[model samples]
Target: MTTLNTHPTTAPATSAAGGGGSLRRVLWAAQILLAAFLLIGSALPKFAGQSDAVRTFTDIGWGQWLRYVTGTVEAAGAIGLVVPRLAGLAATGLIGLMGGAVLTQLLVLEPVWSLLPAVFAVVFAAVAWDRRAESRQVLRSLRRAPSRTP
Candidate 1:
């Protein structure tokens, strides 16, 4: 009888030699910290209408409503980032949001200002890519679920 190795391979590649695995773990820790910091920092100010956030949004010429929408989205993404099962989806959402932020800054703010959002977009993209396999598994399982149509 033949047996299959059914163990799930959900983790990113990590070399057991030369401390490469430890390095990967460190990088992942930094990524999580960066995501939490950026998202929460962006979200809270908009929710509370802090002076800096309000002024920046005002300069963008969009109504205050945009601020609230962005804050809520950022908060949601931040929460999702810490959840093991949802990090990939959260990172994906953050990438799109940060892309919009970068474009807005490019058009309405100093060119240098756009770089911050652009950096966030890149980091989020990396997170999404690292989790791609897990995300694919999640997608497959969802697809296999029975539809609830009456």
Candidate 2:
């Protein structure tokens, strides 16, 4: 089906890619901004052994290794968010990360700090919802790929 503003050939089976190009652009922009923020404010610090990251991880009682692991996931997810095909899946994964962050904040750090992850969770949910079609398409492709095992 085609609307006056959209052609089936030009659009995908997704809202983020089809009917509302403008919205998709906004979402992309948001994702880019968030990824930049995560890389600079969170991921990089952990990898760099910054004092704040060190302190936070120490407080969490999960050891420095957990900091590295969390940073790795955050960095990967941030990078994934910018890849058109991976945004949905990345957002879905980030939502889980954010949920864990929220719980950690409440239980380990400070209760007030949970707000950040909670807000991130909501934003990720929006991106995941918007890109659901792309996520499904990727999954379908994986399912259709021929097995390589001999």
Candidate 3:
């Protein structure tokens, strides 16, 4: 009987050789930092009843409740970024949230600085995309049969 090579083929290593891992780590760190910053900077002021923050939230018609909700989500997403299994999903959720923020700023606020949200959204989207292939590989490995569990 002819023996078959059962070993799986590895993807060309170069696909991830050019700074992909380091870049992905940096992106994850940056996303976590941004989430923390947003949570503290925006949330604190609203929670503290600062005049400018209150006025801005009021004028936006979204109210303080929305601020609380957003801050909580950001904090949760930031925490999730550090966990490998949850990172992809968290990044995806954060990107969606940031995209919504960008749209709100564009349509409702119409400020030139509104682009910042979109920029952040793009960064998070990149992070999610870069990690996706690896995440899939990991999932596939997990689903594979356990070798002779004794």
Ranking by TM-score: 2, 1, 3
Q: What total of clashing residue pairs does each candidate reach?
A: 0, 0, 0
lDDT tens readout by residue for model 2, 43-147: 999999999999999998879999999999999999989987889999999999999999998988899989999998888888898888778888988999797
Q: Give the per-residue lDDT of model 1 (tens digit) for 33-150.
A: 8657756677887888899999988888888889899999888888877765666788899899988988888888887889988887887776776666667778888999897998
Q: What is the TM-score of each candidate against the true structure?
A: 0.79, 0.86, 0.67
Any runs in candidate 2 off by more than 4 Å, and if so which? Answer: 1-19, 148-150
Ordered list by lDDT, greatest first: 2, 1, 3
Winner on lDDT (1 vs 2):
2
Full-model lDDT, candidate 1 = 0.77
Task: In angstroms, give how far residue 14 of model 2 lies from its true place.
Answer: 6.6
Candidate 3 residue spans exceeding 4 A from truth: 1-19, 133-150
Instruction: Please give the distance, in angstroms, between residue 117's alpha carbon in candidate 2 and its true position after superposition.
Output: 0.9
Off by over 4 Å in 1: 1-20, 148-150
RMSD of each: 3.8, 4.1, 6.6
Could you give me the TM-score of model 1 versus the true structure? 0.79
Against the hidden true structure, what lDDT does model 2 obtain? 0.87
1-150 per-residue lDDT for model 3 (tens digits): 997764434443222326745676677678677767766775566567788777766777977787667767777777666665566667788888888787777777766757887887787777677667656765697899688956
